[model samples]
Target: MTVEVGSPAPDFTLKNQDGQEISLGDFKGQKAVLLVFYPFAFSGICTGELCSVRDDLSSFQNDDVQVLAISCDPVESIRAWARQEGYEFPLLSDFWPHGAVGESYGVFSSDLGFSFRGTFLIDKDGIVQFLERNGPGDARDQQGWRDALQDLAA
Candidate 1:
């Protein structure tokens, strides 16, 4: 089942593009997390979506919220992708156990061996405050996420 609002998000410790351990709990108390699960790095839609975040960073980067983009790609690929795309946020590698974290949140697309467009807004308390899932190739409605974050920050 997909994660829902008010439900506690599953905690995970994934490696960032730099191969450093980064856990969902790492940002506790300081910032809520915007967990973005994409299909892959360097994909057309994925790049566009992430670039949008990079272009308007103030919407995501602040004291109240931290944005993290995750994919099943290896750390090396993620590192290169981040450099090419100029993604300032952490590009986490859900690689090793192969989409295990994505599976935990019910976002794994087993057929494609990747994640669909699943976005979860996890509050400081570790509960999901907003969640959205779109079909393959479907871009997200980012306004919804921004609105939710605005309410949370208020």
Candidate 2:
């Protein structure tokens, strides 16, 4: 089962595209977090989804919110993709354990050996505020996330 709304978010530490380690706990008392898990870096659908986030960064990430994109791809791959896409938000590498974190989120596809599309909005208290998951080959509507944030703000 996936992490659900009102449930505590599972804390994790993974390297960012820059090779810097980041943890969910780092934002616990500072800002709510938008955790995005995709299958891979540079894949067509993955690129499109993240590019949208790149283009709408202010709405997706700010003083009140933080965006962390996760993938099973290696740090080197994510670094190249992020640099090419001009993504300002952190793209975290769930590569070491080979999708361990994604599995924790219940988004990992064992047959495909990667994570599907999973998005979670966690409040500053570490409780999940929003949760959505899409299967492989499926795309996501980010507006849902925006709407959720708007609700939080209200």
Per-model clash counts, in order, read 0, 0
* Highest-TM-score candidate: 2
Task: Report lDDT (CA) for all predictions.
Answer: 0.90, 0.93
lDDT of 2 at 30: 95
Worst 10 residues of 2 by lDDT: 1-10
Q: For model 1, how does the per-residue alpha-carbon lDDT over 18-118 read when each residue is reduced to its tens digit? A: 88999999988778999999988989999999999999989987878899999999999999999998888999998879999999888897788998889
TM-score of 1: 0.97
lDDT per residue for candidate 2 within 1-154, as digits (tens), equals 6688999999999999999999999999899999999988989999999999998899999899999999999999999999999999999998878888999999998788899999999998999999999986999999999999998777
| Ten contiguous residues minimizing lDDT sum, candidate 1 | 1-10
- Estimate the TM-score for candidate 2: 0.97
Alpha-carbon lDDT of model 2:
0.93
Residue pairs in steric clash, candidate 2? Answer: none
- lDDT of model number 1: 0.90
RMSD of each: 0.9, 0.9
Deviation of model 1 at 137, angstroms: 0.6
